[model samples]
Target: MTSTLILGGRRSGKSARAQALASTFAEVTLIATATASDGEMAERITRHQADRPAHWHTVESPLYLASALQQADAAGCCLLVDCLTLWQTNLLLAEDETLLARETDALLAILPRLQAEVILVSNEVGWSIVPESALARRFADEVGRLHQRLAAACQRVELVVAGLPLTMKNETGTR
Candidate 1:
């Protein structure tokens, strides 16, 4: 089992990079976290769906990522999570801080136990200017923290910029 974290800003091609990596495996599963609450988000989801290969299995998991990962068959499989930012958004909307902490802990704990190659996509929002609203600031802070923790747990960490991936950490025997 191996875990990798791909971090970049919005439209930084991180998701595309994850897809390319996932394609190398025999079986691929996409854990899409985005929810279509508005027209713009719906269009974005449609575009993402169109971009994915027909053969890859897609699972809509806006919440309960730990359960989803636990249920997935990890052996010889590649699991790609599109972006964690939206997942964080969903958690924040719940207004239960305990749920956020619990979910994040569960996800981090399960990564090491999985047999599949896992690729986690997340937005690097901390590099930008501080957010104006309190909620936005909290979200940015939490996402940044989540990225840090996940990156440490992952075998490889890549930072994508302008469609280019700059490897931060790549363990031995990982192609």
Candidate 2:
């Protein structure tokens, strides 16, 4: 099994790229880590749902991502995680101090050992100035740390900018 991490900023086409790659596999299960707490977010989720193929299965696990991954992963199947940023946000907003760390650790431990091809999408949020709010700062710090750990665990790491993918790391040194 191969694992890939796709990192990009807002509107950088990270989701499209991950979906396109997953289309190559025989079967795909999208592990959506988003919750529509508001109308705008609900619209976004709907749009994403419309963009996917009818045959592709979707699993929504806003706070229980590791469990979803564990259940969906299988040989010859591909698991596409839309965005880790949203998952992190969900964990942070939960107000539970230990949830984020525990889930992050569980994900890191599970990724490298999965039997299916994994495509994880995350936002690159640390390029701009530091945020004034404590919550914003914590979010950036946590996402950065998560990205680093995921990159190390993934076989391929790609950075997307303006809808273009730039390969940062590849275990086989090709593709």
Candidate with top TM-score is 2
The lDDT for every candidate, in the order shown, is: 0.90, 0.94
Q: Kindly list the per-residue Cα lDDT of model 2 for residues 1-175, writing each as its tens digit.
A: 8999999999999999998999998799999999889999999999999998989999999888888999998999999998899999999988788999999999998887789999999999999999999999999999999999999989999999999999999995668
- TM-score to native of every candidate shown: 0.97, 0.97
In the range 2-64, model 1's lDDT, one tens digit per residue, is 889999999999999999999889899999999999999999999998998999998889878
Candidate 1 regions with alpha-carbon error over 4 angstroms = none
Q: Whole-model lDDT for model 2 versus the true structure? A: 0.94
Residue ranges of candidate 2 with Cα displaced over 4 Å:
none
Q: What TM-score does candidate 2 reach?
A: 0.97
